[model samples]
Target: MKSALIILALSFIATFSNAQKKVLPVTNVTTGKEIYAKHCMTCHQVDGVGAQNMIPPLIKTDYVLGDKKRLIKIILNGLKGDLDVNGDMYSGEMPSQALLKDDEIAAALTYVRKSFGNSASAVTIKDVRRVRAANKTISK
Candidate 1:
């Protein structure tokens, strides 16, 4: 009886050990360009040139390459009223994208800074986190 029990237990262990492990599908990696496309492309356009007399072009603009904090705020808080860009005034209203995660915001901003003929520093996740925290404080 003891030998039979031991054999049963060993077989059970062997059955489990030889069982096939679940193979998980690889997760899709989200890129900065992809994020931008999902969020900003409709307004900014594919070339980042924006709409004439409406959405301001992001190319070679201070708004794109100047201050990282302000740029981040624009995305988080949105912008309205009149906006001047390199002597052109854009009356478009930008909706807030506060729902985006820190990493996503950082990636989108980094993509903008580097694209559309603008060469600027990458906006890190830490930078977005800091600004988002400050925004919360200011709002309250």
Candidate 2:
């Protein structure tokens, strides 16, 4: 009976520990730089200067360094219409990148915010998850 009790306790402890372990999503793409290169470099350009009067620049722009939630949504849902960036009117449409996993989105955005002469906070995985959940954005 004592042997059985010890086994049961050990089993419970093992189960609890496994449950507590955090599992981050797996992807072939690692690092924010890689994600940015694959997903964002074409539009924003290698230096993030973007096309003149066309795609908006990511250089110290309010949109990039602004509210984290809005930025996350932009990546998830895409954006249309014109934006007045640093007193310049830029017009373009950004297609939805919702297919990116939460970690991917967070990584790319964090990279953008930190790159292109912009110094903003890193977008956390928790932040992405919360925003994704709030907006019902699903990742493919």
In order, what lDDT does every prediction score? 0.85, 0.85
What are the per-residue Cα lDDT tens digits for candidate 1 across 15-122?
A: 776663322211113467888899999998987989999888878898899999999999999999998999998887999999988888888888888887788888
Superposition-based RMSD of candidate 1 using all C-alpha atoms, in angstroms: 8.0
The residue-level lDDT of candidate 2 at 83 comes to: 86
Which window of ten consecutive residues has the lowest lDDT sum in model 1? 20-29
Q: How many steric overlaps does candidate 2 have?
A: 0
Give a tens-digit lDDT track for model 2, residues 21-40: 64644322247889999999
TM-score of 1: 0.78
In angstroms, how far off is 37's CA in candidate 1?
Answer: 0.5
Clashes of 1: 0
